[model samples]
Target: MSKKNSESDSANGVRLDKWLWAARFYKTRGLAKDAIEGGKVDYNGAKGKPSRMVELGALIGLRQGYDDKVVEVLGLNDQRRPATEAQALYQETPESIAARERKAADRKANNGALVSEHRPSKKERRQIHRFKSDVFSGESL
Candidate 1:
């Protein structure tokens, strides 16, 4: 490939929010921007702006819901791609991967203990509603 074609193929860098959206970390660029502005994303261990340029080898810390992920940028792309391709953009650190798995397992175990086989019956629902009303109204029963 010619030098010009290579340069076109790999641009200088991509915006942080754009990279997050392209990597499938967020459903849309707006969501990614919100997260960045909300302090849910850190670049190189410090808070970053949505418009910050993301280049190869940069460390990114992303908090999505209850999980935190620390990944090193491996590639840069502004356009959203398939899951497999998106995954290639960054590599999660081993410690982050292990921590996430442990947290997931703990959550699963805690939730499993409270799992019910069936939904509540009409009587149960009514009782729950009545109890909530009593509590809110400062009633004894």
Candidate 2:
């Protein structure tokens, strides 16, 4: 009824940082605000501010760990909600999903090829020298 509409559509939207936190993009409003201030978030393809008002169907680009996500705002909420409800507030774009999956697959494929460039420690160098000397000494088994 009228009461419900008033509660849900009071402002028709909420602050970007609050929405980000409510949508579970960030665990807390502080984190969301920090991300916005740090240039880690975009609103409608432009840099976002913590107080920016979020509108439906707006594209938001944010970085989460090693993945960059582009999500379309589906709904607006200011209060943090459960994970399931939060997820319903936005939808990741298909291209973003595909990119994240491809990156994951590429990471998995290259996991075993890691190369270390650090010089051996003194202890490790000593061990290697001992092994080389033993091999050169030709000690019988």
Candidate 3:
């Protein structure tokens, strides 16, 4: 193998935060570091520090908003790269992908129930104002 290929596949590994940022898991290295320190990122099923070395094939479990992702390290790069290149750095487990998609669908469905299609009518607004005034004036609605 070429030196470049060997270096990229080195067993020494890269810093967890740097790899995470380069892999596009976080927008910035600082954010990746914070996530690692906050226990939102796990390496091989154990919580890892920002400076921890993440080797190829290592399992990483990370929480992104409400979704939890488990991916295997496929490649490493110190510098941030394009989205497509970054995506090649890690391979998400099928189960994790399915769970994330299912959760997103559930969230979308639940959100529809809580959203209003339009603003309240003028009469409804007037009633709301009257109720607020009555409460503040110590009068029953």
The candidate that achieves the highest lDDT relative to the unseen native structure: 1
Better candidate by lDDT, 2 or 3? 3
Quickly count the clashes in candidate 3: 0
Clashes of each: 0, 0, 0
RMSD of each: 5.3, 10.5, 6.3
Q: Model 3, residue 29: what's the lDDT?
A: 94
For model 2, how does the per-residue alpha-carbon lDDT over 8-68 read when each residue is reduced to its tens digit? 7536778899899999888889999999999999999999999888999999999988899
Those runs of model 3 whose alpha carbons end farther than 4 Å from true positions after fitting are 1-11, 116-141
Clashing pairs in 3: none
TM-score against native, each model? 0.73, 0.75, 0.73
- Candidate 1 per-residue C-alpha lDDT over 1-141 given as tens digits, one digit per residue, 9 for 90 to 100: 576754564587788998999999999999999999999999999899998989899999999989999999999887888999999999999999999999999999999988878898999889989989989889653
Look at candidate 2 and give me any clashing residue pairs.
none
Badly placed stretches (over 4 Å) of model 1 are: 1-10, 115-141
Report the lDDT tens digits of candidate 3 across residue range 1-141. 576864764456788998999999899999999999999999998889998888888999999999999999998887777999999999999999999999999999999998878898999899989988988889643
Q: What are the Cα lDDT values of the candidates?
A: 0.91, 0.89, 0.90
Weakest 10 consecutive residues of candidate 3 by summed lDDT: 1-10
